[model samples]
Target: MSSYRIIGLFALLGGLTACERPTPPLAAGQEPAYDLTSYLQEQTARLQQEQPPVLKSVITKGQPTETLQLEELDWEKELAIFQEVDLSRPALRDFYREERHTLPNGSTVSIFTKDAEAAAPVDRLQLTVSPLQKLERLEAVVLEENLLFYSKRNISLTAEPGSGNLNGYRVEGVQKLIFGDSLRYRVDANL
Candidate 1:
């Protein structure tokens, strides 16, 4: 083959490989778990394609509540905090204790609590799945504390009952820094 042709072929192959999605790391001997990263990525793609209108409200300490109707949104930016609660990281494989229970309404709940000795930001994750195996809701609590600052966030996402589409989401949190006043805020959005 000609040198130029070979170089072009190599470049094409590299470009193709770069287009492929990277797989999340998994621990040895561990059963396949829900891929929160991929799930959120898919949701972001779907929302981008659908371009749904969102009703959003924001409240801050000592401030009046602000409401807005948004026709366009940066889904990934909005969900960045939720993505930080990913529990499937290889480092956190055995850090969380998992529990499953079935409710009388035929829904199943799975709870993952971070082990006390494990140094992780996500404190807890709770998921509710319907009888049909569709995700009904997801809730997560994240806490970070250090010598300089401390913050906690309670986040929740709800899916439409039958369609399993994202219906709404809420994030409420408080943050305090050394020598700074505490800040509290809440954000709610409906699609």
Candidate 2:
């Protein structure tokens, strides 16, 4: 190749590299908080490795409650909704306000409430940790509204107080689309 062509290619490559933005680190040191994404990821990995049987019950508007006992589950897919509410992202560092409280029962609670003006879907997240810092329960509310559709989800997860192993989870939500009737659904799963 000609020397000029080689130099131009290098310049183009450098420009392309400069245009690419790397994902910012989740921890920004400005806030002391629990890493929700990492914690959920660890739980997902553990569940997948264990392959525990799950009893799941689902109900949808206008439908009968259906129950299933499954020997295996796609843990990643099942936990996708929880993962979507990641509060640890750098971009969300300032989106939610954190409050810490100590209960009379010797548990600590961390609550993150999103700013009213923030565009993030995660509206609120509350986590209860035992005195030893093990997660006991998590509750979250997520809202998504746009021109075409609207959805609100309330999620709750419970873990064994001593083992910190997830024992059950429930998700309840309502969804509606423009010109359509609202639909409500609920899913409860026990491990």
Candidate 3:
């Protein structure tokens, strides 16, 4: 009987010892390190070192008979939007996941998709770069779910204009919008 009681006490002590222990607190002046930001900046620099991509053509299909195409694009003004995108910010970085690919032309394309729950107006964004990582082609599309803003306002993806500093790509999109019956007007930029 006494041996049995001793065994139970030992088991209880062993169980308590096996419980999880808290991590040791950091010492003064010691900071936990996370280098995701530095890695992203390095990748950006490597891509930018190459000649920037030139937009050959941009075509917008579908909508109220306004099929717009831009053959001659002002690289500076057109790309200005991309240059302003700041990915280093914690919120924006957490919101998008970037995937990069190398094309046969020796160029690279990087696509950033917004996380499901947090993604708004802009759902998908893409950038094509030269072999050396220069900007080549840029495209962004906002899904229909994000378009319906107001209860009475029905927005069209192909007919709405939007702008944003998408990661490193600045984009300016223009589309039209229709507000109820007998109230149709062009809406440019919803970014």
Best by TM-score: 2
Q: Which parts of model 2 are misplaced by more than 4 Å?
A: 1-31
Compared with the true structure, all predictions reach lDDT values of 0.86, 0.88, 0.44
Better of 1 and 2 by TM-score: 2
Q: Which digits, one per residue and each the tens of the lDDT, describe model 2 over residues 54-108? A: 9999999999999999999999899888887777676686788888888998988
Candidate number achieving the greatest lDDT relative to the actual structure:
2
TM-score of each: 0.80, 0.82, 0.37
Model 3: lDDT of residue 94: 56
Candidate 3's C-alpha runs over 4 A off are: 1-88, 143-191
**Predicted structure 3, TM vs. truth:** 0.37
- What is the per-residue lDDT of model 3 for residues 1-191, given as tens digits with 9 covering 90 to 100? 99999999999999998894645444575322223234334434543553334323222334353323333334344333333332434445556667777677776566768898874544666655455433444556544432433212222211111221122322234434444333233323221
Candidate 3: how many backbone clashes? 14
Model 1, stretches more than 4 Å misplaced?
1-32
**Candidate 1: tens digits of C-alpha lDDT, residues 1-191:** 69999999999999999997566454565444456787788789999888899999999999999999999999999888878887767667677887778899998788989999989999999988788867789999999999999999999999986766788999999999999999999999999
Residue 45 lDDT in model 2?
Answer: 94
The CA lDDT at 116 in model 1 is 96
